[model samples]
Target: MGTMAFGRSGASTAGWTRRRARFAGTAHWLLVPALAFTLALVVFPFGYTFWLSLNDYQFGHAARFNFGENYAALLHDAVFWQGLGTTFFLYFLSLALQLVLGTYVGLLLNRRLHGQTVARTILMSPFMMPSVVIGMMWLVILDPSLGAANYILSLLGLPPSQWLASPGLVVPVIALIDTWQWTPFVALIVVGGLQALPIEPFEAAFIDGATRWQAFRYVTLPMLRPTLLTAAILRSVDLLRFFDIIYITTQGGPGNASTTLNIYAYRRGFEFFDIGYASAIMIALMALVAIVVLALMRLRRSL
Candidate 1:
Protein backbone atom coordinates (compact mmCIF):
# COMPACT_ATOMS: atom_id res chain seq x y z
CA MET A 1 0.00 0.00 0.00
CA GLY A 2 2.86 2.40 0.86
CA THR A 3 4.66 1.81 -2.49
CA MET A 4 1.46 2.26 -4.41
CA ALA A 5 0.81 5.64 -2.66
CA PHE A 6 4.43 6.80 -3.33
CA GLY A 7 4.17 5.92 -7.07
CA ARG A 8 0.89 7.85 -7.36
CA SER A 9 2.41 11.01 -5.70
CA GLY A 10 5.43 10.99 -8.05
CA ALA A 11 3.16 10.73 -11.13
CA SER A 12 1.04 13.75 -10.02
CA THR A 13 4.12 15.93 -9.33
CA ALA A 14 5.55 15.18 -12.85
CA GLY A 15 2.24 16.11 -14.48
CA TRP A 16 2.12 19.52 -12.68
CA THR A 17 5.74 20.30 -13.64
CA ARG A 18 5.02 19.56 -17.27
CA ARG A 19 1.93 21.79 -17.20
CA ARG A 20 3.95 24.80 -15.89
CA ALA A 21 6.66 24.31 -18.54
CA ARG A 22 4.01 24.30 -21.28
CA PHE A 23 2.39 27.49 -19.93
CA ALA A 24 5.76 29.30 -19.79
CA GLY A 25 6.53 28.25 -23.36
CA THR A 26 3.15 29.52 -24.53
CA ALA A 27 3.69 32.92 -22.85
CA HIS A 28 7.10 33.35 -24.46
CA TRP A 29 5.70 32.55 -27.88
CA LEU A 30 2.94 35.11 -27.33
CA LEU A 31 5.58 37.86 -27.03
CA VAL A 32 6.86 37.19 -30.55
CA PRO A 33 4.56 39.68 -32.33
CA ALA A 34 5.53 42.65 -30.12
CA LEU A 35 9.24 41.79 -30.41
CA ALA A 36 8.96 41.53 -34.19
CA PHE A 37 7.19 44.90 -34.44
CA THR A 38 9.86 46.62 -32.32
CA LEU A 39 12.67 45.17 -34.44
CA ALA A 40 10.97 46.25 -37.67
CA LEU A 41 10.62 49.81 -36.42
CA VAL A 42 14.25 50.09 -35.29
CA VAL A 43 16.05 47.91 -37.83
CA PHE A 44 14.37 48.93 -41.09
CA PRO A 45 15.29 52.63 -40.94
CA PHE A 46 18.89 51.90 -39.91
CA GLY A 47 19.25 49.34 -42.70
CA TYR A 48 17.87 51.80 -45.26
CA THR A 49 20.27 54.53 -44.11
CA PHE A 50 23.24 52.18 -44.39
CA TRP A 51 22.09 51.12 -47.87
CA LEU A 52 21.81 54.76 -48.97
CA SER A 53 25.34 55.43 -47.74
CA LEU A 54 26.80 52.86 -50.19
CA ASN A 55 25.25 54.44 -53.27
CA ASP A 56 25.32 57.67 -55.27
CA TYR A 57 21.92 58.75 -54.00
CA GLN A 58 21.00 62.14 -55.31
CA PHE A 59 17.51 63.47 -54.66
CA GLY A 60 15.14 62.29 -57.44
CA HIS A 61 18.06 60.75 -59.31
CA ALA A 62 19.15 57.18 -59.97
CA ALA A 63 21.28 55.65 -57.19
CA ARG A 64 24.37 53.81 -58.30
CA PHE A 65 26.16 51.64 -55.74
CA ASN A 66 29.54 53.37 -55.52
CA PHE A 67 30.71 50.99 -52.78
CA GLY A 68 33.12 53.22 -50.73
CA GLU A 69 33.47 56.45 -52.72
CA ASN A 70 31.17 58.49 -50.44
CA TYR A 71 33.26 57.64 -47.39
CA ALA A 72 36.45 58.46 -49.30
CA ALA A 73 35.07 61.84 -50.29
CA LEU A 74 34.18 62.57 -46.67
CA LEU A 75 37.74 61.70 -45.61
CA HIS A 76 39.18 64.09 -48.19
CA ASP A 77 36.81 66.94 -47.39
CA ALA A 78 38.52 69.69 -45.36
CA VAL A 79 35.14 71.15 -44.43
CA PHE A 80 34.14 67.87 -42.84
CA TRP A 81 37.36 67.82 -40.79
CA GLN A 82 36.74 71.38 -39.59
CA GLY A 83 33.20 70.54 -38.58
CA LEU A 84 34.47 67.52 -36.60
CA GLY A 85 36.95 69.76 -34.79
CA THR A 86 34.22 72.23 -33.84
CA THR A 87 31.98 69.44 -32.58
CA PHE A 88 34.63 68.09 -30.20
CA PHE A 89 35.44 71.53 -28.84
CA LEU A 90 31.78 72.40 -28.27
CA TYR A 91 31.09 69.04 -26.65
CA PHE A 92 33.93 69.08 -24.08
CA LEU A 93 33.64 72.75 -23.12
CA SER A 94 29.86 72.65 -22.63
CA LEU A 95 30.06 69.35 -20.73
CA ALA A 96 32.61 70.64 -18.18
CA LEU A 97 30.64 73.82 -17.52
CA GLN A 98 27.35 71.98 -17.26
CA LEU A 99 28.70 69.43 -14.79
CA VAL A 100 30.29 72.06 -12.56
CA LEU A 101 27.45 74.54 -12.67
CA GLY A 102 24.84 71.84 -12.47
CA THR A 103 26.49 70.23 -9.44
CA TYR A 104 26.65 73.56 -7.67
CA VAL A 105 23.03 74.32 -8.45
CA GLY A 106 22.03 70.83 -7.39
CA LEU A 107 23.73 71.32 -4.04
CA LEU A 108 21.89 74.57 -3.51
CA LEU A 109 18.57 73.08 -4.53
CA ASN A 110 19.10 70.13 -2.20
CA ARG A 111 19.14 72.43 0.79
CA ARG A 112 16.01 73.47 2.72
CA LEU A 113 15.82 77.10 1.68
CA HIS A 114 13.01 79.60 1.66
CA GLY A 115 10.89 79.32 -1.49
CA GLN A 116 12.63 76.13 -2.54
CA THR A 117 9.72 75.03 -4.65
CA VAL A 118 9.48 78.36 -6.43
CA ALA A 119 13.22 78.50 -6.99
CA ARG A 120 13.30 75.03 -8.55
CA THR A 121 10.41 75.87 -10.85
CA ILE A 122 12.16 79.03 -11.99
CA LEU A 123 15.46 77.24 -12.49
CA MET A 124 13.74 74.75 -14.81
CA SER A 125 12.39 77.41 -17.14
CA PRO A 126 15.38 77.53 -19.48
CA PHE A 127 15.64 73.76 -19.88
CA MET A 128 11.93 73.56 -20.46
CA MET A 129 12.13 75.98 -23.39
CA PRO A 130 12.45 74.52 -26.88
CA SER A 131 15.90 74.67 -28.47
CA VAL A 132 14.72 76.98 -31.25
CA VAL A 133 13.02 79.23 -28.72
CA ILE A 134 16.13 79.33 -26.54
CA GLY A 135 18.21 80.27 -29.58
CA MET A 136 15.84 83.05 -30.55
CA MET A 137 15.66 84.35 -27.00
CA TRP A 138 19.43 84.52 -26.72
CA LEU A 139 19.78 86.02 -30.21
CA VAL A 140 17.60 88.94 -29.19
CA ILE A 141 19.25 89.34 -25.80
CA LEU A 142 22.79 89.21 -27.21
CA ASP A 143 22.13 91.32 -30.27
CA PRO A 144 25.20 93.58 -30.87
CA SER A 145 22.95 96.62 -31.08
CA LEU A 146 19.76 97.36 -29.12
CA GLY A 147 20.10 94.12 -27.15
CA ALA A 148 20.00 93.75 -23.39
CA ALA A 149 23.42 92.05 -23.11
CA ASN A 150 25.34 94.92 -24.71
CA TYR A 151 23.21 97.44 -22.89
CA ILE A 152 24.17 95.88 -19.58
CA LEU A 153 27.84 95.79 -20.63
CA SER A 154 27.75 99.46 -21.62
CA LEU A 155 26.31 100.38 -18.23
CA LEU A 156 29.33 98.69 -16.62
CA GLY A 157 31.74 100.86 -18.70
CA LEU A 158 32.71 97.99 -21.02
CA PRO A 159 32.68 98.11 -24.81
CA PRO A 160 29.80 96.33 -26.50
CA SER A 161 31.04 93.20 -28.28
CA GLN A 162 29.49 91.09 -30.99
CA TRP A 163 28.20 88.01 -29.20
CA LEU A 164 27.07 85.82 -32.08
CA ALA A 165 28.49 87.34 -35.23
CA SER A 166 32.11 87.31 -34.18
CA PRO A 167 33.86 84.09 -35.19
CA GLY A 168 35.83 83.95 -31.95
CA LEU A 169 32.74 84.47 -29.80
CA VAL A 170 30.22 82.32 -31.68
CA VAL A 171 31.26 78.93 -30.31
CA PRO A 172 31.78 80.17 -26.78
CA VAL A 173 28.53 82.09 -26.75
CA ILE A 174 26.71 79.05 -28.06
CA ALA A 175 28.32 76.99 -25.30
CA LEU A 176 27.20 79.48 -22.71
CA ILE A 177 23.64 79.48 -23.99
CA ASP A 178 23.64 75.69 -24.02
CA THR A 179 24.94 75.68 -20.46
CA TRP A 180 22.20 78.05 -19.38
CA GLN A 181 19.46 75.96 -20.88
CA TRP A 182 20.57 72.45 -19.90
CA THR A 183 22.33 72.93 -16.57
CA PRO A 184 19.01 72.58 -14.80
CA PHE A 185 18.48 69.11 -16.22
CA VAL A 186 21.74 67.93 -14.70
CA ALA A 187 20.87 69.70 -11.45
CA LEU A 188 17.50 67.99 -11.21
CA ILE A 189 19.04 64.58 -11.75
CA VAL A 190 21.73 65.23 -9.16
CA VAL A 191 19.19 66.61 -6.74
CA GLY A 192 17.14 63.44 -6.91
CA GLY A 193 20.25 61.35 -6.44
CA LEU A 194 21.18 63.39 -3.40
CA GLN A 195 17.79 62.94 -1.86
CA ALA A 196 17.89 59.18 -2.38
CA LEU A 197 21.28 58.70 -0.72
CA PRO A 198 21.26 57.01 2.72
CA ILE A 199 21.53 59.43 5.64
CA GLU A 200 23.78 57.17 7.72
CA PRO A 201 27.00 58.16 5.98
CA PHE A 202 26.27 61.88 6.28
CA GLU A 203 25.33 61.62 9.93
CA ALA A 204 28.48 59.66 10.66
CA ALA A 205 30.61 62.24 8.81
CA PHE A 206 29.16 65.03 10.99
CA ILE A 207 29.87 63.01 14.11
CA ASP A 208 33.54 62.61 13.00
CA GLY A 209 34.02 66.44 13.10
CA ALA A 210 34.43 66.69 9.28
CA THR A 211 33.91 70.12 7.78
CA ARG A 212 31.12 70.49 5.26
CA TRP A 213 33.57 70.75 2.36
CA GLN A 214 35.50 67.71 3.56
CA ALA A 215 32.28 65.75 3.94
CA PHE A 216 31.24 66.67 0.42
CA ARG A 217 34.65 65.86 -1.02
CA TYR A 218 35.13 62.60 0.84
CA VAL A 219 31.63 61.24 1.22
CA THR A 220 29.11 62.82 -1.13
CA LEU A 221 31.34 62.83 -4.19
CA PRO A 222 32.23 59.15 -3.89
CA MET A 223 28.63 58.15 -3.46
CA LEU A 224 27.40 60.27 -6.36
CA ARG A 225 29.73 58.74 -8.98
CA PRO A 226 27.00 56.75 -10.74
CA THR A 227 24.65 59.70 -10.87
CA LEU A 228 27.36 61.98 -12.24
CA LEU A 229 28.28 59.46 -14.93
CA THR A 230 24.63 59.13 -15.90
CA ALA A 231 24.37 62.89 -16.27
CA ALA A 232 27.57 62.92 -18.35
CA ILE A 233 26.26 60.21 -20.67
CA LEU A 234 22.99 62.06 -21.25
CA ARG A 235 24.77 65.37 -21.94
CA SER A 236 27.44 63.81 -24.15
CA VAL A 237 24.98 62.11 -26.50
CA ASP A 238 22.84 65.22 -27.01
CA LEU A 239 25.81 67.59 -27.36
CA LEU A 240 27.35 65.35 -30.02
CA ARG A 241 24.23 65.62 -32.19
CA PHE A 242 23.33 69.19 -31.22
CA PHE A 243 21.93 71.04 -34.24
CA ASP A 244 18.77 73.06 -33.84
CA ILE A 245 20.04 75.82 -31.52
CA ILE A 246 23.26 76.31 -33.45
CA TYR A 247 21.37 76.23 -36.72
CA ILE A 248 18.82 78.78 -35.61
CA THR A 249 21.37 81.02 -33.85
CA THR A 250 24.53 81.17 -35.97
CA GLN A 251 23.49 79.13 -39.01
CA GLY A 252 27.18 78.14 -39.16
CA GLY A 253 27.90 81.80 -39.83
CA PRO A 254 31.13 83.87 -40.04
CA GLY A 255 32.34 81.28 -42.58
CA ASN A 256 31.81 77.88 -40.91
CA ALA A 257 32.96 79.12 -37.55
CA SER A 258 30.23 77.21 -35.71
CA THR A 259 29.48 74.53 -38.26
CA THR A 260 29.08 71.29 -36.36
CA LEU A 261 29.07 67.83 -37.95
CA ASN A 262 25.27 67.92 -37.64
CA ILE A 263 25.00 71.20 -39.58
CA TYR A 264 27.53 70.00 -42.12
CA ALA A 265 25.57 66.81 -42.60
CA TYR A 266 22.42 68.85 -43.08
CA ARG A 267 24.08 71.06 -45.68
CA ARG A 268 25.53 68.09 -47.56
CA GLY A 269 22.32 66.09 -47.68
CA PHE A 270 19.69 68.76 -48.12
CA GLU A 271 21.37 72.00 -49.16
CA PHE A 272 24.04 70.49 -51.45
CA PHE A 273 22.01 67.38 -52.47
CA ASP A 274 24.89 64.96 -51.85
CA ILE A 275 22.80 62.39 -50.01
CA GLY A 276 25.32 59.57 -50.27
CA TYR A 277 28.16 61.60 -48.78
CA ALA A 278 25.89 62.95 -46.09
CA SER A 279 24.87 59.44 -45.20
CA ALA A 280 28.53 58.51 -44.74
CA ILE A 281 29.00 61.41 -42.33
CA MET A 282 25.94 60.36 -40.40
CA ILE A 283 27.17 56.78 -40.15
CA ALA A 284 30.60 57.90 -38.95
CA LEU A 285 29.05 60.12 -36.31
CA MET A 286 26.75 57.34 -35.21
CA ALA A 287 29.74 55.05 -34.76
CA LEU A 288 31.66 57.65 -32.78
CA VAL A 289 28.71 58.30 -30.44
CA ALA A 290 28.20 54.58 -30.02
CA ILE A 291 31.79 54.11 -28.90
CA VAL A 292 31.57 56.90 -26.36
CA VAL A 293 28.26 55.66 -24.98
CA LEU A 294 29.43 52.05 -24.82
CA ALA A 295 32.57 53.03 -22.94
CA LEU A 296 30.56 55.07 -20.46
CA MET A 297 28.02 52.27 -20.03
CA ARG A 298 30.85 49.82 -19.33
CA LEU A 299 32.42 52.16 -16.83
CA ARG A 300 29.10 52.58 -15.07
CA ARG A 301 28.71 48.83 -14.92
CA SER A 302 32.22 48.28 -13.55
CA LEU A 303 31.76 50.90 -10.87
Candidate 2:
Protein backbone atom coordinates (compact mmCIF):
# COMPACT_ATOMS: atom_id res chain seq x y z
CA MET A 1 0.00 0.00 0.00
CA GLY A 2 2.85 2.48 0.91
CA THR A 3 4.66 1.75 -2.37
CA MET A 4 1.51 2.48 -4.38
CA ALA A 5 0.98 5.82 -2.57
CA PHE A 6 4.61 6.91 -3.29
CA GLY A 7 4.25 6.16 -7.03
CA ARG A 8 1.02 8.21 -7.26
CA SER A 9 2.66 11.22 -5.56
CA GLY A 10 5.65 11.13 -7.94
CA ALA A 11 3.32 10.98 -10.97
CA SER A 12 1.28 14.02 -9.73
CA THR A 13 4.45 16.09 -9.15
CA ALA A 14 5.68 15.41 -12.71
CA GLY A 15 2.28 16.34 -14.17
CA TRP A 16 2.19 19.67 -12.25
CA THR A 17 5.68 20.57 -13.50
CA ARG A 18 4.60 19.96 -17.09
CA ARG A 19 1.47 22.12 -16.61
CA ARG A 20 3.54 25.02 -15.23
CA ALA A 21 5.95 24.81 -18.13
CA ARG A 22 3.07 24.88 -20.61
CA PHE A 23 1.56 27.93 -18.90
CA ALA A 24 4.84 29.86 -19.17
CA GLY A 25 5.11 28.97 -22.83
CA THR A 26 1.58 30.26 -23.42
CA ALA A 27 2.49 33.59 -21.75
CA HIS A 28 5.58 33.96 -23.92
CA TRP A 29 3.48 33.37 -27.05
CA LEU A 30 0.95 35.99 -25.96
CA LEU A 31 3.69 38.64 -25.53
CA VAL A 32 5.14 38.07 -29.03
CA PRO A 33 2.53 40.22 -30.83
CA ALA A 34 3.00 43.15 -28.46
CA LEU A 35 6.78 43.06 -28.82
CA ALA A 36 6.48 42.88 -32.62
CA PHE A 37 4.07 45.82 -32.69
CA THR A 38 6.42 47.96 -30.56
CA LEU A 39 9.35 47.16 -32.82
CA ALA A 40 7.41 48.11 -35.93
CA LEU A 41 5.98 51.34 -34.55
CA VAL A 42 8.73 52.68 -32.32
CA VAL A 43 12.08 51.03 -33.07
CA PHE A 44 11.71 51.24 -36.87
CA PRO A 45 10.97 54.99 -36.87
CA PHE A 46 13.83 55.70 -34.47
CA GLY A 47 16.31 53.84 -36.70
CA TYR A 48 14.99 55.61 -39.82
CA THR A 49 15.30 59.05 -38.23
CA PHE A 50 18.86 58.34 -37.07
CA TRP A 51 19.76 57.24 -40.59
CA LEU A 52 18.23 60.40 -42.03
CA SER A 53 20.25 62.51 -39.63
CA LEU A 54 23.51 61.04 -40.86
CA ASN A 55 23.01 61.96 -44.55
CA ASP A 56 22.53 65.09 -46.66
CA TYR A 57 18.95 64.14 -47.44
CA GLN A 58 16.65 66.66 -49.06
CA PHE A 59 13.30 66.60 -50.75
CA GLY A 60 13.33 65.31 -54.42
CA HIS A 61 16.97 64.21 -54.34
CA ALA A 62 19.11 61.22 -53.56
CA ALA A 63 20.60 61.25 -50.02
CA ARG A 64 24.38 61.40 -49.89
CA PHE A 65 26.01 60.40 -46.63
CA ASN A 66 27.51 63.57 -45.17
CA PHE A 67 28.58 62.03 -41.88
CA GLY A 68 28.17 64.63 -39.04
CA GLU A 69 28.09 67.78 -41.19
CA ASN A 70 24.43 68.52 -40.38
CA TYR A 71 25.09 68.40 -36.66
CA ALA A 72 28.17 70.57 -37.19
CA ALA A 73 26.08 73.12 -39.11
CA LEU A 74 23.57 73.20 -36.27
CA LEU A 75 26.40 74.21 -33.93
CA HIS A 76 26.80 77.38 -36.03
CA ASP A 77 23.10 78.08 -36.67
CA ALA A 78 21.69 81.16 -34.92
CA VAL A 79 18.06 80.14 -35.28
CA PHE A 80 18.71 76.73 -33.74
CA TRP A 81 20.34 78.37 -30.71
CA GLN A 82 17.41 80.79 -30.34
CA GLY A 83 14.97 77.89 -30.50
CA LEU A 84 16.89 76.01 -27.81
CA GLY A 85 16.84 79.09 -25.59
CA THR A 86 13.10 79.46 -26.02
CA THR A 87 12.55 75.77 -25.35
CA PHE A 88 14.46 75.83 -22.05
CA PHE A 89 12.81 79.10 -21.00
CA LEU A 90 9.30 77.85 -21.55
CA TYR A 91 10.06 74.40 -20.15
CA PHE A 92 11.40 75.53 -16.77
CA LEU A 93 8.89 78.37 -16.35
CA SER A 94 5.86 76.24 -17.14
CA LEU A 95 7.08 73.35 -14.98
CA ALA A 96 7.60 75.56 -11.92
CA LEU A 97 4.19 77.21 -12.27
CA GLN A 98 2.42 73.90 -12.81
CA LEU A 99 4.03 72.19 -9.82
CA VAL A 100 3.27 75.05 -7.43
CA LEU A 101 -0.29 75.56 -8.61
CA GLY A 102 -1.05 71.88 -8.94
CA THR A 103 0.04 71.16 -5.37
CA TYR A 104 -2.19 73.95 -4.07
CA VAL A 105 -5.14 72.75 -6.11
CA GLY A 106 -4.62 69.15 -5.04
CA LEU A 107 -4.63 70.15 -1.38
CA LEU A 108 -7.78 72.18 -1.93
CA LEU A 109 -9.57 69.25 -3.51
CA ASN A 110 -8.58 66.91 -0.71
CA ARG A 111 -10.57 68.94 1.78
CA ARG A 112 -14.18 68.18 2.72
CA LEU A 113 -16.07 70.55 0.51
CA HIS A 114 -19.52 70.68 -1.01
CA GLY A 115 -19.77 69.95 -4.76
CA GLN A 116 -16.37 68.22 -4.64
CA THR A 117 -17.29 65.75 -7.32
CA VAL A 118 -18.45 68.45 -9.70
CA ALA A 119 -15.33 70.49 -9.05
CA ARG A 120 -13.03 67.55 -9.73
CA THR A 121 -14.91 66.65 -12.92
CA ILE A 122 -14.69 70.21 -14.24
CA LEU A 123 -11.05 70.59 -13.28
CA MET A 124 -10.09 67.32 -14.99
CA SER A 125 -12.02 68.13 -18.16
CA PRO A 126 -9.23 70.19 -19.72
CA PHE A 127 -6.70 67.35 -19.47
CA MET A 128 -9.04 65.06 -21.42
CA MET A 129 -9.57 67.60 -24.23
CA PRO A 130 -7.26 67.34 -27.24
CA SER A 131 -4.36 69.80 -26.97
CA VAL A 132 -5.15 71.15 -30.44
CA VAL A 133 -8.66 72.00 -29.35
CA ILE A 134 -7.31 73.84 -26.32
CA GLY A 135 -4.93 75.74 -28.56
CA MET A 136 -7.69 76.84 -30.96
CA MET A 137 -10.04 77.78 -28.13
CA TRP A 138 -7.40 79.87 -26.42
CA LEU A 139 -6.33 81.47 -29.68
CA VAL A 140 -9.82 82.88 -30.11
CA ILE A 141 -9.98 83.94 -26.47
CA LEU A 142 -6.59 85.66 -26.64
CA ASP A 143 -7.20 87.48 -29.91
CA PRO A 144 -6.13 91.09 -29.42
CA SER A 145 -9.03 92.86 -31.10
CA LEU A 146 -12.04 90.56 -30.60
CA GLY A 147 -10.90 88.54 -27.62
CA ALA A 148 -12.73 88.60 -24.31
CA ALA A 149 -9.37 89.11 -22.56
CA ASN A 150 -8.86 92.54 -24.05
CA TYR A 151 -12.50 93.37 -23.54
CA ILE A 152 -12.12 92.59 -19.85
CA LEU A 153 -8.98 94.74 -19.74
CA SER A 154 -10.93 97.59 -21.39
CA LEU A 155 -13.63 97.28 -18.74
CA LEU A 156 -10.99 97.39 -15.98
CA GLY A 157 -9.48 100.64 -17.33
CA LEU A 158 -6.35 98.85 -18.52
CA PRO A 159 -4.53 98.67 -21.82
CA PRO A 160 -5.34 95.84 -24.24
CA SER A 161 -1.85 94.53 -24.91
CA GLN A 162 -1.11 92.14 -27.74
CA TRP A 163 -0.44 88.75 -26.17
CA LEU A 164 0.85 86.35 -28.80
CA ALA A 165 1.77 89.05 -31.26
CA SER A 166 4.35 90.67 -29.03
CA PRO A 167 7.76 88.95 -29.05
CA GLY A 168 8.40 89.46 -25.34
CA LEU A 169 5.02 88.11 -24.29
CA VAL A 170 4.66 85.28 -26.80
CA VAL A 171 6.76 82.73 -24.93
CA PRO A 172 5.11 83.49 -21.62
CA VAL A 173 1.67 83.31 -23.22
CA ILE A 174 2.48 79.90 -24.65
CA ALA A 175 3.68 78.75 -21.26
CA LEU A 176 0.52 80.08 -19.61
CA ILE A 177 -1.76 78.33 -22.07
CA ASP A 178 0.14 75.06 -21.63
CA THR A 179 0.03 75.36 -17.85
CA TRP A 180 -3.71 75.98 -17.86
CA GLN A 181 -4.28 72.81 -19.82
CA TRP A 182 -1.85 70.60 -17.87
CA THR A 183 -1.93 71.74 -14.24
CA PRO A 184 -4.92 69.51 -13.65
CA PHE A 185 -2.95 66.48 -14.75
CA VAL A 186 -0.31 67.26 -12.14
CA ALA A 187 -3.05 67.77 -9.58
CA LEU A 188 -4.58 64.41 -10.39
CA ILE A 189 -1.28 62.69 -9.77
CA VAL A 190 -0.85 64.63 -6.54
CA VAL A 191 -4.29 63.55 -5.44
CA GLY A 192 -3.44 59.90 -6.07
CA GLY A 193 -0.31 60.19 -3.97
CA LEU A 194 -2.17 62.05 -1.25
CA GLN A 195 -4.79 59.33 -0.97
CA ALA A 196 -2.29 56.52 -0.60
CA LEU A 197 -0.56 58.17 2.39
CA PRO A 198 -0.92 56.75 5.89
CA ILE A 199 -3.21 58.70 8.19
CA GLU A 200 -1.30 57.88 11.37
CA PRO A 201 1.35 60.55 10.93
CA PHE A 202 -1.22 63.28 10.35
CA GLU A 203 -3.18 62.12 13.38
CA ALA A 204 -0.02 62.29 15.44
CA ALA A 205 0.58 65.72 14.06
CA PHE A 206 -2.90 66.70 15.16
CA ILE A 207 -2.24 65.39 18.68
CA ASP A 208 0.87 67.58 18.81
CA GLY A 209 -1.29 70.67 18.04
CA ALA A 210 0.29 71.19 14.66
CA THR A 211 -1.29 73.70 12.33
CA ARG A 212 -2.58 72.61 8.92
CA TRP A 213 0.29 74.30 7.11
CA GLN A 214 2.77 72.71 9.45
CA ALA A 215 1.40 69.25 8.74
CA PHE A 216 1.53 69.88 5.03
CA ARG A 217 4.96 71.45 5.08
CA TYR A 218 6.63 68.95 7.31
CA VAL A 219 4.87 65.64 6.83
CA THR A 220 2.90 65.87 3.59
CA LEU A 221 5.67 67.39 1.53
CA PRO A 222 8.13 64.69 2.49
CA MET A 223 5.61 61.99 1.61
CA LEU A 224 4.86 63.61 -1.74
CA ARG A 225 8.46 63.69 -3.02
CA PRO A 226 8.03 60.67 -5.28
CA THR A 227 4.82 61.98 -6.85
CA LEU A 228 6.35 65.40 -7.46
CA LEU A 229 9.38 63.81 -9.08
CA THR A 230 7.14 61.72 -11.30
CA ALA A 231 5.10 64.74 -12.34
CA ALA A 232 8.27 66.70 -13.06
CA ILE A 233 9.75 63.94 -15.21
CA LEU A 234 6.59 63.52 -17.29
CA ARG A 235 5.94 67.24 -17.70
CA SER A 236 9.55 68.11 -18.54
CA VAL A 237 9.64 65.49 -21.31
CA ASP A 238 6.50 66.90 -22.93
CA LEU A 239 7.66 70.50 -22.51
CA LEU A 240 10.98 69.74 -24.20
CA ARG A 241 9.05 68.65 -27.29
CA PHE A 242 6.43 71.39 -27.09
CA PHE A 243 4.82 72.22 -30.45
CA ASP A 244 1.04 72.03 -30.70
CA ILE A 245 -0.13 75.11 -28.79
CA ILE A 246 2.54 77.35 -30.28
CA TYR A 247 2.01 75.84 -33.73
CA ILE A 248 -1.69 76.63 -33.78
CA THR A 249 -1.42 80.03 -32.13
CA THR A 250 1.89 81.55 -33.19
CA GLN A 251 3.28 79.28 -35.93
CA GLY A 252 6.65 80.23 -34.38
CA GLY A 253 5.98 83.93 -35.10
CA PRO A 254 5.28 87.15 -34.93
CA GLY A 255 8.80 86.48 -36.30
CA ASN A 256 10.14 83.32 -34.67
CA ALA A 257 9.48 84.66 -31.18
CA SER A 258 7.86 81.47 -29.95
CA THR A 259 9.92 78.97 -31.89
CA THR A 260 10.87 75.96 -29.76
CA LEU A 261 13.19 73.22 -30.95
CA ASN A 262 10.23 71.22 -32.15
CA ILE A 263 8.90 74.18 -34.12
CA TYR A 264 12.38 74.84 -35.47
CA ALA A 265 12.59 71.28 -36.71
CA TYR A 266 9.18 71.49 -38.40
CA ARG A 267 10.07 74.75 -40.14
CA ARG A 268 13.40 73.37 -41.28
CA GLY A 269 12.10 70.03 -42.53
CA PHE A 270 8.67 70.84 -43.93
CA GLU A 271 8.80 74.50 -44.87
CA PHE A 272 12.40 74.86 -46.05
CA PHE A 273 12.89 71.20 -47.07
CA ASP A 274 16.09 70.84 -45.05
CA ILE A 275 15.46 67.24 -44.07
CA GLY A 276 18.98 66.41 -42.92
CA TYR A 277 19.35 69.45 -40.68
CA ALA A 278 15.90 69.00 -39.22
CA SER A 279 16.69 65.38 -38.47
CA ALA A 280 19.84 66.46 -36.64
CA ILE A 281 17.90 69.07 -34.63
CA MET A 282 15.18 66.56 -33.77
CA ILE A 283 17.70 63.90 -32.74
CA ALA A 284 19.48 66.39 -30.51
CA LEU A 285 16.20 67.41 -28.93
CA MET A 286 15.36 63.76 -28.28
CA ALA A 287 18.74 63.21 -26.65
CA LEU A 288 18.28 66.23 -24.40
CA VAL A 289 14.84 65.02 -23.34
CA ALA A 290 16.20 61.54 -22.61
CA ILE A 291 19.00 62.93 -20.46
CA VAL A 292 16.59 65.14 -18.49
CA VAL A 293 14.18 62.26 -17.92
CA LEU A 294 16.92 59.88 -16.86
CA ALA A 295 18.34 62.41 -14.41
CA LEU A 296 14.91 62.98 -12.89
CA MET A 297 14.27 59.24 -12.72
CA ARG A 298 17.54 58.73 -10.94
CA LEU A 299 16.56 61.43 -8.47
CA ARG A 300 13.20 59.76 -7.98
CA ARG A 301 14.90 56.44 -7.26
CA SER A 302 17.15 58.10 -4.71
CA LEU A 303 14.16 59.67 -2.97
Native-to-model Cα distance after best TM-score fit, residue 27 in candidate 1, in Å: 3.6
CA RMSD per model (angstroms): 2.2, 2.6
Ten-residue region with minimum lDDT total, candidate 2: 1-10
Task: Please estimate how well model 2 matches the true structure, expressed as its whole-model Cα lDDT.
Answer: 0.94
lDDT score for residue 204 of model 2: 100
Compared with the true structure, all predictions reach lDDT values of: 0.92, 0.94
- The digit string of per-residue lDDT tens for model 2 on 111-152 reads 889999999999999889998999999899999998898999
State which candidate has the highest lDDT. Answer: 2
Per-candidate TM equals: 0.93, 0.90
Error of 1 at 52 (Å): 0.7
Model 1, span 1-303: residue lDDT tens: 788888988898899899989989998999999889887997777788888899999998999999889898888999889999999999999999999999999999999999999999999999988898988989999999868999999999999999998999999899999999999999999998899999999999999999999999999998998999999999999999989899998888779999999899898899989898888888888887888889999999998
* Cα RMSD of predicted structure 1: 2.2
The per-residue C-alpha lDDT of model 2 at residue 74 equals 92
